[model samples]
Target: MERLVQTIVQKRLLPLVLVALVFIAAKIIFALITIVAADEAYYWVWGENLALSYFDHPPLNAWLIGLTSIFFDNNVFAMRLPTFLTFAGTLYVYWLFACRLFPKAPERAFLLTTIGFLASPTLFAWTSIVYNDHLLIFLSLAATYAFADYFSAYSTDERTSTKPLYAGALLLGLAALSKYNAAFLGVSIAALVIAHPRLRTLLLRPHIFVAGLLCVLMLTPVLLWNIQHDFASFELHLVDRYDRPLFTSFKADTFIRYLASTFIYFGPVLMIPLVAIFFRQRDLDQFGNMTIWIARLMIAFTFVTFTALSTRGAVHWYWGAIAYALMLPFLPILLKNMWLYGVHIVLGLTFVVYATVNYSYAPVELLLGGQSSEVARVYGWPEAGELAVQLERKHGPIYLATTGYPTAAQLAHTLDRTDIYDLDPRPSHFSFVERKAIAPGADAVILHDQFGNLEGTAARFERFSKIETFVYTAHGVDINKFEFYLGEGFISDGDQ
Candidate 1:
């Protein structure tokens, strides 16, 4: 028993334990406050419904969040728990990949995994939210790990492992169902197999057949969902891709900015070492050719895709996420370099302090629009609920209005009302109205402060004798005000 314990400790259990501690501590600190953003609330609603897909994302994250909330109840901690789990799971998987690849430098692999986890802003931020991105990230890393294992066997030995290849294919299929971005993993794997001489034998192996079968099996549900829904998922993704020329004058500038931001967001300390590892192929070759191929494929794909998409809105996070797992191999080497290690420590401390300061009472007033006393009061759902209740009492059937689905969902959830409407002027159900027509007699209007041309709407409401406003805050941040107006046409009891 004593020997087993020592064996576990010596085999990098300590690092794994430390990773868990960091994950739990970060989550607990963040969950002490109310939900920090609208996206968090929107995803929570997805969990409540437990659907196969949402208007914006796939169902994996919603399912995870729903499962977590079942145990903890629908509060901040419950909503954010899945994110914490994803972070922990991601670290563990990365460590596993490192161990398999760099057996000689296990400590280096462990350190790199830790640094990569801390440096990724998208990973950090999404981990705190109940969103598809978190779940997608987990599956993506898992798929990469499985692929590494499958291909590694070919280089080391003449025989191939059918299990790992099949597992990887199944995971890849599940990942594709989770999010469309996962298609890249398939492309990366195929490219690696075709390019590497030793791995070409995989084409003749039964594992290929098994992988194909597994992918089809795992993807069956998503395919059915798409078929039933007129392939709305595919259409949504394609429509989102803005049509732009391949090369533009600003391409170089935009790509450079994205590259720089990736370094900053991932933490300069960790990024420096990651770059060093890429240049030192000898250090990386110790792992396996597939590991190196996966890393190179991710980087190459991201740059090419981002370059093409830059002419449209440059969304860096999506590309950055694909490269996350591949970057883990170099983290330890970066830390071993004294200069990079010092920078990383400083950056890590800065992030903790910044996060803490955001929750401090001194900043609460300013952060929550200067009127709210309690951070929870400002950030919580009560204010919105109260406004909804009051409006319902006066108006026969109150209808809520918002520019976005998240805001609409927030009001609907808090007020215990589903008649809530979106007033974005596009085709939608609920009560549809122009910005200038919001008045008490026409029910209530919920408008975000960021909305332009409020003067017209306010003037129309002022014409009515009944006009009231309520303020709401989320996590001590005042999101917007709810304006209720009773127009001239409003009748007393006898008028009916």
Candidate 2:
């Protein structure tokens, strides 16, 4: 018993366990204090319906959350459980893969895995939201690991393992189903096979073909769903967003912002080593050829995707998360030089301080400072939802309109009503007004100050009593103010 205990301690299992505990504790703490962001709430709605696809993302993540919500209820903890568990699972898998990659340096492998977990800002952000990114990232990493192990096993002996190859294919298929970005894995793997003479066996293997078939089979549901829905998912993702011109100055800013955000979110300490490893040509030979290929592919894909989609949208949290994770094992190799390791430690500590100061459990007012109104504009819908409910009871079946869909969706969910409408003339990003315009009967309308032209329509209607106004503040700034107006000749305030 003493020997076993000693062995476990010496193996550093306790520290890893502590790190995991800290990770979960932080997530739970954040979950309690933080309201669901609009994106999270929207995705929760997607989970409720359990469709094959959504307007924004794949269905696997929603399905997972929806299943959990059945047991845990539609609350923060329930919504975040899938994300939290996926992150934790990814950490474990990273360790497993790291151990396989570095059989001689067990401690170093463990450290690198931990650093990877810490350096992944994308993972941290998505883990807090009920989004598909976490699932996709996990599946992508799994495929990478399986592919590495399978190729390594094949290289050692003539016998090929069907399990790893099949599993890798299945994971890659699921990843593709999660997001179109998974296609890059195939590109990366092909590059690896072409680069390494030892890996040429993979090209000749029949199991690779079998794996491809399995991947296609796994993704059949998405294809069928697209067919049934007139390919709305693809159209929305591919065509609808392309209305903007292809060339834009925003491309440079988008690329730079993504790079900075990724570093900030994942702690800089962990990223420095990864970046150092990525740029060092000499260190590339230390790991399997697969790592080099995966890293290069990820970088190329990020650059290409950013350049192409620069006019459409900025790089989002899950966009390149897996690529970051794939580069984890190589960080230690980069840290082999004392100067590189020293710089990494300083940057890592700086990030720790930044995250700590930014997220300390301070009062909401203190956190908002003077920009409270701006913060409110961005995240004020929840407060608006509360106000909307109060107005609904006072005004009776009120017709609500907003410039955005997120506000409308949140208001509808909170009020347990869907009569809310979008006041915007066209279907803008968050156009909930489209629904409200067609609502039956006379309806009261709510408008934000930012809806410049839409507010003019309210003037043409007869204004009755004004509902109470609520001011939303964020970072001590007022981004938007909400005012409620009843239709012309409706009951006055004194009618009650």
Candidate 3:
């Protein structure tokens, strides 16, 4: 026993194994306690109704959730298992990449990278939530590792084999299927290929063309879906999301917010090393140069591209998690200062603790004008679904409706009903949820809020009878308010 323990300690395998186990445990616990956010509920609905693609994101997240539902019965924690598993996969891929990047001290590299992942608020929290980014992050990193392996193997032996390239291409394609942002990986690869003469030769190879074809084949689902839908998804992302003119409004302010959020979400301690790596770049040894270059380029390209986009509209803080993750291999560069390194770990762990305990406590009223608060999204949803069920029981199968996708989705999941209509102009996955509008002149129950357009919602019905108001409260603070109305006649859009 002593010999086994000593061998493990000497190999530094104990810490790595402990960290992985601890991370998995923490994620499982957190997912169990974490309230299902609106986007998560929305995606769960997608899983309930399997499809080729969705309006906001591709079908991978939904597919994972759907598969998990088969086993876990759509429990919140079970629904989140896919994200946790993918994040774990992401960590292992990072370990492989770090080992390749710093072969001299692979164990230490992996240990520090795992710690860095836990320290980042976004990365840590993302593991507990089901989102498309989790899949994207895992597949993108896997693709990155495959390319690094290919570069190292090809450069060392000048082998013309195409297996690694094909693997990388397939992973990249899957990453793209997870989220549109995976395009950054392709750009980073192109930049690396263009900058490295040896890699640039890949462009002329027939195998490279074959790899490209593989990526295109992987993306065929998204393309075919878009074509069938008249590219509504493209318009939603490229045009609808950017409501403001580029460079014409609050450019500096938005850019500053983006940078500040980047620092916070990435963890301030990790940012110090990230910025240091950004400015103090140098060529790694021949075998690792391509890997390092791709990392640097991905970091630069993602942040810089989003920085520019932030000028036009809000760029979410979590969007930069992947960029911060790419900084793992360079973390050893900071180990020269043990005190700072220690502080980095301390700060990161502290943030993780703080976020785990208090991330869902935001108290806000349900409003329709702009972004709703975390409390508004999480709280009162179950009660609203329950209320809808009671109303349906009382009134004999009334259509349940709401004014927004978030409410519609959360309530739908709680009630296990897909017929809830979002009676608003905004486009959502509901458009493809395979449900017809409540028949004209049919009775329906509308969940109304004070701050929402009650007038417009009321206008959709010929008459409404007010029901009791439902309030979700925590610690003497009301988190959300819902006013229920039983409408006598539902009016479809064409009726007016």
Best by lDDT: 3
How accurate locally is residue 198 in candidate 2, as Cα lDDT from 0 to 100? 79
What would the per-residue lDDT of candidate 1 be over residues 78-135, giving only the tens digit for each residue? 6777777777777788778768766876655665566556545555655556666676
What tens-digit string does per-residue lDDT give for candidate 2 at 21-107?
555565556555565655666566556666666556666876776788789855667778887777777777777766766666655
Better of 1 and 2 by lDDT: 2
CA lDDT of every candidate: 0.60, 0.61, 0.75
Candidate 1 accuracy as TM-score: 0.78
Clashing pairs in 3: none
Model 3 TM-score, 2 decimals: 0.90
How many backbone clashes does every candidate have?
A: 11, 33, 0
In model 3, where do residues sit more than 4 Å from their true spots? Answer: 1-4, 11-24, 251-253, 280-283, 359-372, 434-436, 449-456
Model 2, stretches more than 4 Å misplaced? 1-24, 156-158, 194-206, 242-256, 266-287, 311-313, 337-383, 398-401, 412-437, 440-468, 473-481, 485-496
Residue 473 in candidate 3, Cα distance off native in Å: 2.3
Question: The CA-based lDDT of model 3 is what?
Answer: 0.75
Best by TM-score: 3
Superposed model 1: Cα runs more than 4 Å off: 1-24, 31-36, 69-72, 104-108, 241-260, 283-287, 314-319, 359-380, 413-419, 425-447, 451-466, 471-496
